[model samples]
Target: MGMKVRGISYYDYMLLLFVGGVIVLSFPANLLRVWGVPFFRGPYYDVIFVIFVVLALCNLWMSKDSPLPSYYFAATLLLFSTMVFAIGVIRGNENVIAGMKYFALPLIVYMLLVGRRFVLSFYSSNFLWSLVVGSHVFCLLFYYAFLYGRVYPGIGVPSISFAALFFLAKQKYFLLSVSLLVVLLEGKRSLLLALLITMVFMRMVRLSVVGRLIYTILGIGILVLSMYLGLSFLAGITGSAIVNRINLLNPFSGSFDILLGSSGRAGELLSYFRGKDTLELLIGSGSGFTYEWQLGYASTQEGEIKGYFHMTPANYLAAGGLLGLVPFVWMMLLPFRAGALKESNDTRTVAFGLGVFCVVQSFFGFNLATDAVSIIFIIGPMMLLSEQRRPGGATALRSNSLERTS
Candidate 1:
């Protein structure tokens, strides 16, 4: 592991150390099940969850030679959050705690992974690509089965076969088609839309002509398959009535027409914040409001069954508040910018899309600590492979420098 980057060779055991920590955390998160920690938890089966966290850490630590962004943004965000929590404490407001979940994701990821080489590591590129596609396939299939009433106790359908098809079936039109099916079938339009937009954007603005053509053909096939399956899934779940209530997914649903319903919650906050010229839009939302808002926030008043799962970007605003989220958001775009500024290939393109996907996924149904690491996060970052030649000046794999983190 000894390699000189910017004249530093301390990377010798960083990867091992990181992997070891992950292995320890991973076991508790997976094996101990109900006993490990609070905010994060999962069944004994979620090895992927713990593995990714480790990967993210290792990716950063290993990439020690690369200078990451100044931590000002992340630091400020944490500061704002801490101050808000402090205020909430004095007033005994609980809503500030509600911000915990929303605030945790990027903070933890950035605090651990940012400014690290693993993110751009060539060794992790391939792993990340596999991670994104594989996790989506699993979530997509499981969700499809659930909607169709086909989900039993275990993996439904031929997961292995589906996985093969998933990787091999990459096509623009096909991806779009399949994405639409997944949206309707799983009733998770956010993820479906994220994939669709990503694939289309990649094809039009990012990929080569040959890649686009291949992706298009596959896209068509996936569309047809999705249509067939999605219809059946809907039929098994809610029947034609799903069509009637589909409009409710808009967030400004029928239920939000009245006072403080999810729709009007914003109006409430805006009204509350109105006439406040002295407020810091760039820094924080004051305390005591967390309890008043969350236990009582409009995301709930809107009649949402799961108030915390609001699809609005407003959640980002309200939960972590402004100051806390700014740098986190910026840090998120760091990789995409790096890819664009630096010459990259399909792997970097794919990573860009997945990073966007994870961002979008957060706005919807995901939890703070599902007790597992999300597959998208893992494979998305792990997929980069080595691009440099071997040491001793040889060009063979592993014989030379091996991979480089993108």
Candidate 2:
């Protein structure tokens, strides 16, 4: 029995190891919270979502010889929303309009890869990795230095994440390193800590001797650099200060318990978005909410709150209203696309890597909710698990030959 376990193929084990990547990556993403009505909000939330959707679709067409529905994951999410709407209806959340809005085009389709052809397709694999790395870098750069005269870098559509996704794909250590440092120096204490835990855990579990050596050197280098930056760039912050800031999100006894347990922001959102004098608030305002709800479009009021959102659920509410939100509740319950990857070498590794990244990033961000971004984040993995697949091979199940777009 022990020998049998050992005999599991590297690809299969790789598939399993993929989960580690997902856990490490997802903590920084955003939300899809549903209350009396469905609403969402955040900084750069839409940018992340759009990017996720686009990658998912690209992955769908990229997937080879698979009969998966490509749309099953998204459809399932939409269907789940319907069920949740039933609950809202019963409770008379008066948010049925909010719940039902998600059905418009509530389907996600993933790419299907054929055989081991893509297993070692270095170009494609590295391309995707580059996208991840570049996005990470761009985001960090945006957070720290700003870009193209924009206060927020990735906020621009023809911006960093987009530029890197298809064009400049590969593992960019420079960008990655910069991100690590920036997150540390900036006050995003939660993100830095989460990433540290994730990196250490991965090293402990699967990093090879060479990888570990490289990583140890890398870690020491980063710490030393951070110390320099702390003294030069961020004079006020200390190691203890960094640790304390990160602790706010830790769920620890002293610092964590009373966490967002500090409800000023939460209370404000409820009052501003969910309070009584709503015109179409129940059904939701429109198909995308930003800062300004009294006025259409994603803008916010002038002053301190400008460019920021008070109501968190504004994204969903804006896109579909309760009328559309109903079709997406419990949407994530579907196994991540990795669970549906076929038993093969190249497909398994690529699927696992992509799936894990999407899951981790989406959880921490919210790119999973955008149409373009959701392509890779939510549906790309599903491409491997669509209804096109069955007990037998997809070739055997083909009725009409169709070239699905990658």
Candidate 3:
């Protein structure tokens, strides 16, 4: 299965698939509708999901052993997630399938990646670097398109920027600068704060003194250059008023309001918590059952659009209750635990940082629950899981030995 095409290995192909799929799939479906394009219409909406699933199943079938941790925490998390899915099926929540497409698909893809018997070791510099470059290019496209009006990217911008930064920091500073510009342009205060958190974390754990100093200068340069670039386009495209709308000082305040807002799950969570019995608080309404489809007030060319509040944790808690929520939170931590088992400190830190970034981003957007951003979530942690296996672990040991001698 690890055959080469010309010179490129099957491992490289899968890496490409993971990176490319995330970028292409992140394009707003609403953009296609706005243009009335028949592209990717109908049953093809899940194309990205299908690609990952097929690849995952192939890898899983061929895999000699499981990549899953045998720890009690890992067991507890998986069991809870399974119970949530089963309850959703029992409750006849049609959207459970959609949730599977988003959530479960990534989980499968991640396991396949971390396992042996398919693809290269995740520790391969080639694989890691390619992912970094690919993500940086996507971030460039995201901002450049927004600047020139080719697409309307939204909410998850800061998370995407920082994720790229995690990879870029060790490789290329220029790409990181460009990505920082994109995050600035996209203008989500919550995500911006998340980016800051990631940067601070990286500075504390990952970077050497020289690396930190370089980044500090690069960050200042990026800020100055981005301002010039943005101001030049202020009147025509980069809309300065949008920046005014950003309450940078009050980033988390809005999240609190959303929790208290009538339009969202805040009230529902309260009612469910105050239930007459304890089991009701324990089980939740069932997966994908909390939110209902409703008409949106914003009228598009297709008429009044319809959707639901997908504020992930709240919705998941409302649906799966604590039964679903606890496991979901644990699953988020599993990557870090897996990474902790890796001997390479840098690799472990990067994997854990990626996990932190994803978890933080989830609060403002459903990036972890959506196919596009799930790619980011899946690749980083699974790469760490790959480290615990054979050839990959061997390579890491060699590198560690060389470093000790040096």
Best by TM-score: 3
Q: Per-residue alpha-carbon lDDT of model 1 for 1-406, expressed as tens digits?
A: 2222232123423532443234234322322233234443533334544454565567566657754444464566567557656654664655655545344444445535443333333222233224333454555554444434432211211112122222322433454344344344444334444454444443322545676577767776776576556544443333343342333333323422323323334444554345534444433443434312323244445332232323323444443456545644554454343243222454455445545444544444332223122322332242222122113211222222213244
lDDT of 2 by residue, 187-248 (tens): 44323333443343222213456775888687768766664554344433345745554443
Sort by lDDT, best first: 3, 1, 2
TM-score of each: 0.50, 0.41, 0.64
1-406 in candidate 3: lDDT tens per residue? Answer: 1212233345545655565444433434433433345764543456655666676678656654654533454455456557667887887876776655544544664544544312222322333334444554565565456543443333333334544545554555665575566566555555665675555554333456677588767766776576556544442432343443342222332322443222333433343344336665568655555432222222221222222234457645655667667645754554444344444565455555555666766665556556444444435454544454556574543332211111
Task: Evaluate model 1: give its TM-score.
Answer: 0.50
Task: Estimate candidate 3's alpha-carbon lDDT, on a 0 to 1 scale.
Answer: 0.49
Evaluate residue 403 in candidate 3 and report its C-alpha lDDT on the 0 to 100 scale.
16
Q: Which of the two candidates, 2 or 3, achieves a greater lDDT against the reference?
A: 3
Task: Give the range of the ten consecutive residues with the poorest summed lDDT in model 3.
Answer: 397-406
Q: What is residue 298's positional error in candidate 2, in angstroms?
A: 18
lDDT value, candidate 2, whole model: 0.37
Please give the CA lDDT of all the candidate structures.
Answer: 0.40, 0.37, 0.49
